[model samples]
Target: MGQSSSARHRRNLTRPSQISSSMMDGSSKGTDLVQEDGVIEGHDYISSIPDDVLSSIFNNLSTSDRKISAVVCKRWLIVEGQGRNRLVLNARQELLPIIPTIFTRFDSVTKLVLRCDRRSVSIDDESLIQISLRCQNLSRLKLRGCRELTDVGLAAFSKNTKYLKKFSTGSCLFGVKGMNAVLENCKYLEELSIKRHHGVLEPVSPDFIASDSLKTICFREIYNGHCFGPLIIGAKNLKRLKILRCMGDWDRIFQTMSTRKDNPIMEIVLERIQLTDAGLESISRYTNLETLHLVKTPECTDMGLISVAENCKKLRKLHIDGWRMNRIGNHDGLVNIANHCSNLQELVLISVNPSSESLEELATKCKTLERLALCGIETMGDIEISCIAEKCVELKKICIKGCPITDKGVEAFAWGCPNLVKIKVKKCRDVSGKVIDKLKARRMNLVVSMDSIQIEPESVVDDGGDGGDGGESEPTASSSSSNGGSGSGSVFNTRFGLLAFTFRRWSIGGGGRSV
Candidate 1:
């Protein structure tokens, strides 16, 4: 009965005339006061609230939500007039017609975020020019999936927004030519992200350098079939740089950037690029680096990995694929990293064979490690895993996919690591169903996946070759007494028991078999 009345109240509130002068007064509380002819009668709703409170609420909403709320009524539209430091208009082509109206109302917007759906809306030159003219104070602009914005629109923004500090354009079709004006004009710009864009014309001019204020820049998927030396030279003050799928003259780029004295480069990310020892040596000159990610670099070698470990002393986060590369350090790069980079907290080593001693060394030295991924590692056995479980107390998430570990590893991990919350052991052959049962019994959240239903061949055979001397195996009378009712072999019973136990344990939240 109460729910029905509440629904009716909500329906009445949706009506245009439900808000009236009486409702504005403090007396009426039960019903929504309204006039007879469906007209809202109240002035205090807008005039009474403080401007600061209204602006705070407006800033909290997303770009689209703000646009919808702005057009509800004259009073709400007037609320847009309040000075807001940041304004985000994302994916509302319907709101495009109302941009001028919003601009006329709100003249004090500083940061503007424009996100459009590539399939639906096309942000043409006129729209962008209008925005540049109206929001003159816009210092930071973020455009995502805006395909229609060309060089003309970008030029307007560059020339108009003199104080622009940060700009991010993602999934756009424009290239370096469109951004030439901005890079040349926006002297105060600090951060820039140009991701997944194509058709790069040559940079403006070698003489036209990037703003010294530029600190963090990302050039992702900038496949223009040319070197990025000119672009890198422009951003002299760049501290953090991400170069993805732009593998051209990295050696020269790094060597040039290392020449900077005052504003040295710090963080570097090279994902899916072809980097070799020469490239790594060029990168090694940037000794001030803090975070480095080398993902899917097929040509990477142990010499390169060792160069990074030896040079970059302040390295904090390191992520590298271990499968493609053969050697790491003198033996493997893992030992070099453990010796040099003592401050590493987040480590992701893929398909690398880290020895038991090196694993123990990492667990002891990198005490601040919070997230670790040792996927596709065939050499690390139960002993190495146990060392991590015992020493890395702060570890929250550990992924051990494609490792050869059994119940001993799982038991050791569960017993030692108290704060572990998530574990993924996909394609592990030795982990049995009994381990899953033990995990459930301990009320632990564990995700363990097996690749095949067949029992592992290693579990059946004993250490010695003493199963049988003659052609037929011996079935002793004493063994029958211990075998219960079913006289099948102990190996068969263990396998069947594991299968049955796992079926029951599968009902728990995070355990399954993957074929």
Candidate 2:
């Protein structure tokens, strides 16, 4: 009986959405839907509001709720569509038949996504050209799994959509030629992100000249991404860059970037690559860097850390995942971070072995530090945690995972960091509820979480061999995540949460936040 009533309710709600284009044209822009007295034929009186008022309300609503409002009445549908500035359409071949109609209804869209499932036939060049004509005002375009798109289609669309400022595509077949088309025709393009692009590995760096207007570029899983070295070097005004799992001779490229005099990079994320101390040495040349995330890097050493500390004193957020590699930094090299980069606000060390002396130094010098996460540090015992509790007075959020700290170190929190409010503890077997309660009792406002955090599937990284330069052939698929239970692997599993947690926290540069 309830299912029947639910089906009937849906039918009644959808009846109002059957309005045709002729009816929409004939209806007064500000008038009520069914009656001039602000009463619908069978719907509520709420939508009787003026078009501007309805649009204002829709603007404040979330995208899902606005979609619901669009189905209420013809006037509401028109107002909601007008207020909708971002739209994502399924880029299947079937959608081509109604491209004109869809664009006509949502004519004001400024950010558009053409996404198709891998199993379906994607929209081709003709559809892209048609979309380009309809969405001339689009500032951001994301193409996902659109395998039918090619350089010719991209160039054609690029010629028509000069207003585009941000372009992101993934699982698409378009290569460097299509990528260059956007750079050439889209004069205002400032950001470009490409993932899994099959044909970008062949070396073409010498011919590429990126637009000076570009500010940010991100590449993910684009093997041999170093072929775009000229593009990166040519982007004179580029400020932020993120390239992850894009195997290539990035170390050499980093060396090349350091030689430029107009370098303006302020934030960068380099992950799962063949990064080495040479790249870090080159990165140290970015004197204005404020945020840096070097994840899963094994070749970097204390010299790189010292170089960055000595040069990029303006850095506010720093994160490094050493993956149990003790070579990343030690007492002398890591101490430079605290001694020179005094403005640091947030620090995250994963699978990194830092000495107690560096911890004390960091707490003493980086007084402005507010958030800290130390995970998989085998030697981070009472001394290190004590240093954090005693000196990091401004600290608010802290996460300690898979450390050997005992109840004595845990007890230090009872009187330390008056500003501390939240703490997350995981895989610490020595922590007892009695001491936890004592700390909570001492700091009445503090919240302690001892949850057995589990690893997320997407957050796991397999120990892969050192990355190599992108070859001419395309890459194959591989799964990189694993599960953990009550055993030896549990330690690594529970610590995975902190890996994602700290990465997210450090991504927020100066609290203003960066992507």
Candidate 3:
């Protein structure tokens, strides 16, 4: 009986090959035999897919998954080589060891994204030089958060990668000198983003300003601490210019470039800059502007904002923050924006008080307004918000932080704005969970955040319940007492808190807060 069973098992294995001619006759027994082979032969299933289809599948995988997929088999390795156009080498310490080998396999890469954690990983000069030597067909290169790249590495890269078009090095440690080397060599570059480098030298000179293909330039958090003349002059044909945390004689820079009628800048972002009315007027002459962001420009007054609204008629999006308009009434600047920029779609105004009438004008005139953010405006009531909600039917997002609004305000929004999808009320004390629940029921798509209540600081109470003038009333004594009092009271008390508070009060009362 055992010999007979062994012969039956061997016959079961070779039965499909023996009856190949019978399978062509469409017999039920042959079909069942092929199905059984398919269930047992898992490798054969993947082998049926063509190389081109496998390459397309590999292109959609993540970097780690792609590395694993490449090692599945010789066929998969070839498929990975065929899909070399989709190579994104994020700089991991482990990945650094295999980069050379990976580059050797992918010799025809077109778009390469090199991402590194600036705080942890350090990309040295040798690595960049190696990359430039190996990847010749590299066109789009994005180096995000790479800190160890200096001028020598950039010079090597720019000298090698001549076909580069879209280059973005965001939050890198490259100084202006390194960037100067890159701009000088990469003449075919189109889009550039250089963020958060506190260097003192200029990046581009007069000799490197002749690129007709360049479209976007972002200088975010680049504090050169000197004049921006050379940088601005080099970006004469830039359509988008973003200057964040830069200090210089902006008025002179704007005046010098205002007369260039042949060159027109389309978008400008001046965040936390010291800009005056003259600088704003000079920038307003660019009639082709589509987007403008003046965030945290405390020195800019309502007159400057009014001038921008009146002049830049083609403006589509406007974001302004920390512009104290106590001199100009609530409706003046907003009225100008409503009357002139009728095509406005996105508006963000923080700490700027606008009346209900101005909100009505904005809602009625700017019918295309979609996203609105009014943060830190303590005076805006439910009536003004309701006016915006009722008139601006296209409004999709409303972010109100540090605003004095209650459940009544939430009710007004629920009733007036039927199309509202998102509402963020951070630091809004009066917004209750009940109101949020009501809105969630009415508008199922609505998203509400109650982060205000959870983020409040704990209030302290005095030991003397009668609120008498205790020793804790003194700023020095209060801080020293809270710090568990270093035994030498006089020096520690006077040096730490009392003197600092006194100096701060004196400086504020002496009218010394100016640019």
Candidate 4:
């Protein structure tokens, strides 16, 4: 009886190849024991895992890897479909033909990024509509470089996404119809970022009702300003507005805002926008503003800035940038702002050199100032930095660029500002790497960086031949010139390398060239 039972057990145990086929046919249970290559193994453990637990494991994988993982088994395919919440299909234009199928696979996706290459075929209305119909849970969508996307496609997509909160698209051919579609349908839309859209030339009627839920709006490299007027008027809850490299009369938008007594805007950013003192005066009506960014607006002067400071008492962050040092001026604006906005925590100045008196007053009055960024400020040196360190007790971050500052200035910051956590020094040739190293050594936890400067000079030199044959061997003139040529070549290569490295770093680290 024992021998007969053993024979039956051997007959029941199947090979690995037969196990997969039998499992698909529902002939084998997941808990069944199996024999693989004549070796007995325990019951399948992976499929026994709960869906939620397996989903968590798949969440950590890349989108491409997840697609590949789906083919492993039916269970993995199910997990890939049910678990994915974020989908980023970057440069996958080849999949444009079957976008609906792709969307069907990832039905649970909430945040979607469909970024295509400039040279590839663009996604059309049908594809977008398919996505909108399927991915109802999508909250954030970023469409980049889809040049063929028209107002029809945009409207079709926007009409379906009722829950979308944030939407950003660049290099599209959409116009007012598309904008109106989104504003009319997505009542809860909080943020909209439109960049390099060529078709936004026509005006949006002021009577058009837009969702008041918009809090942030960003326009970058757009040619027309007609659409902005309606958006500014409709976005009653707007807090942050960033306009960069956009050509148009932006003063009208501010003028419109000035008429609204209940404007809830707290943060305003005007980068490379053409506006004069009148525009600034119009913006001064918002007394509740907490953050303001004015970068590369040559038409704005000290008078315009002073108006903003006098009115916006609750201001905490301020960034003023200019194209040229001469275009910006040092005046009582800084002092007055410091006096009024005592709670100011961050200040950024570019191309505008603040006077010692003004900086001293700012350091004294704005005791809560924590982050300071000075770029291309020719007058900023040891005195200004020292004053900032001494008075701004809460200071934690300092970024100095293109300023002729030396070790003395930075050393003062290290000694005076005990709370200093990050110091980024770039294009300040006078500050050596040795001083940075010393400062880092002094404050072990402090983050210090001297851009493009080699810490140890000896590391780049060749002393192998010079050490042994020093006394008797006198160097000839030709050899010296050859060495000089080599040195010059090395210097050129080093500078080129450093410049390339700096540019690459800026492209990645710096958000944009606007400020």
Candidate 5:
């Protein structure tokens, strides 16, 4: 009896596969599992799950992934629509008609991005207002290339997103009034970023300044920064501040802003703005300052660096780019930094000629220094390279770009820097494949990265080009992918790479996004 039952169990399992030939031959027969009592049981699959349970599962999926999840069945579609709380919608004109329905389905969305192609027609005022009216729970909103939105729509939309915490807009055709309108309406905002937002006769209004609640603010390519001086000055709790390519007397603006007493500012990134030593001197008041990045500010000399080092003793990272100017060298700025900023960990110097004396001081006093980058400095050669290799015991990653280092300098790390694990070399004329191979042979586990974007360095100390390296607050530009792909131009030396990286990294809304 036991053997017969076992044979029956085996037969039941093999019956489904056995009937496949008949089904392939266009048989009308149906397949169903039948119990001994002759009752048929259909495979309910995932559809049997309760709607609430399915909604919970759908909530964890991304907008695109949830679309796939919704296709499981009719009930799943409703659950996914109700559970989705984050969305990115393409704002092409043709899709404008369906946006209301889409927002209705994803009514719970709190974070949203409406992006439009440059050549495509973007949604206008009505569409934006309608979207804001529906997604009223929105906490974060980003609009890119939606040029038709005027003050009327911006005001209406801001009213709806009362809970909005983060707002980012770029390339929008709006003046200071429209920008301020959002700040006035969205009282709950904590982060704000604006790009290319300017128009004539910007109605000056400071009563609705959002600085009190703001922790981070980034302005890129803005022409009229002076108008917003009162807004910046009012930020008592501002932590991270980044300003790049904003044309004006930033020297006076920054100096005034930095003079605020009881300053809690920790990280400050100034790039491509007209900054001078006079402007940077006020940063000394930020005793809590931890990270400082001065990029392409040609006017800032040794005096600015010394002032920061003397006061900001808690500094953990320092990145300086002298750009096309070479006035930052032959001073005690780096030496003073080494003496006072004992906790410094990461340092990147570009076109700022660091003598053996300064590098030696950093290697010796800054025992905590882990990552070091030196690019396009004429003074950086075998001697300076050897000094770093001999000291800097905690050094882990080193990046060299367009420096005058040769085989001896490149190969020195093979025997030095016991904790070193990765090395990056770019645009250097003297570093050879043979030397790199020999160095790699010695350090079997080390990651040695080299790129052949060999653009010749100009002024004996130039790093060729900016290459969009905005280290601290400007994360999008400082990425490895950005460095590898663009802003440094191409291997053939066109400005296309720089343009591409510039748009990606410096676009105010998406750039300096370290809030």
Candidate 6:
């Protein structure tokens, strides 16, 4: 107790000499000190990094990976929330508890997809209000299977988020009141897509205010949506409209809209609807129409196209389905459109039997035609393909599906269409593997190959040819390195990592990186 400074120093110096041999030399494995708490010991190096750098790192990861990164630490969670622009929230019942936290973190979100599980408690008005309040800058919003949402929530959204440009709601229970709320409030609304929604079962009478900013409107699987006269009248600048699987007097609506002198409707798509020749006649008034798609509208005949051809001179893209081989090729609607619509560039025909004369006329008259798709036309033989190849001088891409064309037709088509860059064919039983390989070898500069490899004559039909974008095929590991060639239709995969990095850099800007 009374030791002097020298004695204390001497004791400290002798302490190392008195250490246990097992601990000092590490001779006995059991003698080593071990932590029993099962905790990992590591410095928080990732969290220590600046927020901007961490955000940059997270942006490189996929959406799923970003989610995993968020739970790594509190700092990562904050970064993920603040930097997020696009968010997809599914399984509402499970996420309901942490939704408020998510909203608080992702204040910068612009595009949000909210899907509610219908079997559980649907996302209600409260949830919609919370989202509208949190994401004020939201430009695009998709609400799917949200049966509990109502007009009140939509009203709140319109009142709070005026910047909404595009909105899509599917499998919802909202009706005309909800639609009115959005149309009335969203001043800058450009596009609206509604599917499997109820409440517009009857005619929605027009109000005084008209939406001048609306450009496109789509209705799918909506019951009695055909009586959308008031909405059509309100959207004076409406260009593109798509209606599918809805019942009501669409003919009357088209006739009503035709009366308006300021109508600028350009693109119209009707599928699985009760549109007849009378409705088709009404569509003819919009001479400025460029793209028209009619599917499963059996009531439309030669007379309908004749009426449309008289006025719609600016037509460029045309798609028609539900044509029987005997009905279509027999001096039917194709002749009228081919004769009238000279500027037509892209044509997609499903279950159509286009006459040889009509085909010849199309090849000659529609000199500007570039893309042609023939689907489900079993009768389309070598003659039609040969004629199209020879006549359509600027034909770039041809998608043939469910046709019974043999070597003669295919070879003729390949040889005739000099400007052809890509050819996608499916369910042609007669085409052999050798033929496909030869075509690929000859046109190495072009994209020439068959999807779903088969050397036999009999093959199963996978799907109708996707005319637009030349039937996108899955990318291969070998094809990933090559760039899209000089040809217009040669599809190539861009490295996702580089694309993400570029987008991150552009979105965050140079200043954010320094943080």
Best TM-score among the predictions, by candidate number: 2
Q: What digit string (tens of lDDT, one per residue) describes model 3 on residues 35-140? A: 3344432225688898888888987897789889899899898779867774666765456567788887787787777777656776677788888888876777
How do all the candidates rank in terms of lDDT, highest first?
2, 4, 5, 6, 3, 1
- Give candidate 3's TM-score: 0.74
| Candidate 5, 76-129: lDDT as tens digits | 777887877667788877766898789777778887888888898888888988
**Clashing residue pairs, candidate 5?**
487-497, 487-498
Runs with alpha carbons beyond 4 Å of true place in candidate 4: 1-41, 62-69, 90-97, 325-329, 453-515
- Residue pairs with clashing backbones, model 1: 328-333, 329-332, 329-333
- The list of candidate 3 runs beyond 4 A from truth reads 1-32, 36-43, 62-64, 81-99, 111-126, 143-153, 170-178, 198-203, 225-228, 323-330, 440-449, 452-515
TM-score versus the correct structure, for each prediction: 0.69, 0.82, 0.74, 0.78, 0.79, 0.76
Candidate 4 local accuracy as lDDT?
0.73
Question: All models: lDDT?
Answer: 0.66, 0.77, 0.67, 0.73, 0.72, 0.70
Which order, best to worst by TM-score?
2, 5, 4, 6, 3, 1
What does candidate 4's lDDT look like per residue over 21-121, in tens digits? 66788873533556534543654568788988888877778667877888899988978787887776763446656777777777888888887888787
What tens-digit string does per-residue lDDT give for candidate 6 at 1-515? 89999866644442223236435776553233323332223324455788988888888898789889899878788988888877878836556567788888888888888887767777778778877887888888888888877878788888888888888888988777778888888888888888888756655656635478999888898777865668876788999898988877688888888988857999898987888788888899997898888776777776787788777999987777754524332356778878889998788777667677877888888988877877667558998888888888888667776567776787775467778766766556565545666665555444543546423222322223322211124233222121212222222111111221221222223113000
- Better candidate by TM-score, 1 or 6: 6
| Model 3, C-alpha of 457: deviation from truth (Å) | 33
Worst 10 residues of 5 by lDDT: 506-515
Q: After superposition, how far is residue 155 of candidate 4 from its true place, in Å?
A: 2.6
Native-to-model Cα distance after best TM-score fit, residue 231 in candidate 5, in Å = 1.2
Across 1-515, the per-residue lDDT of candidate 2 in tens digits comes to 55788666644442244345426678543233444333345565574677788789899997788888789878888888887787878999898889999988889998888889999999999999999999998888888899998889999999999989988888998777888889989989988887887766566546678887899888889877888888888888899999888887888888888988857999898888888888999999998899898888778888888889999979988987887777885677779998998898778888877888888999998999988888878879998898789999999778887788788887898889888766767666666556667776677667665644222223322222222111113233221232122354666555343354433533342244001
TM-score result, candidate 5:
0.79
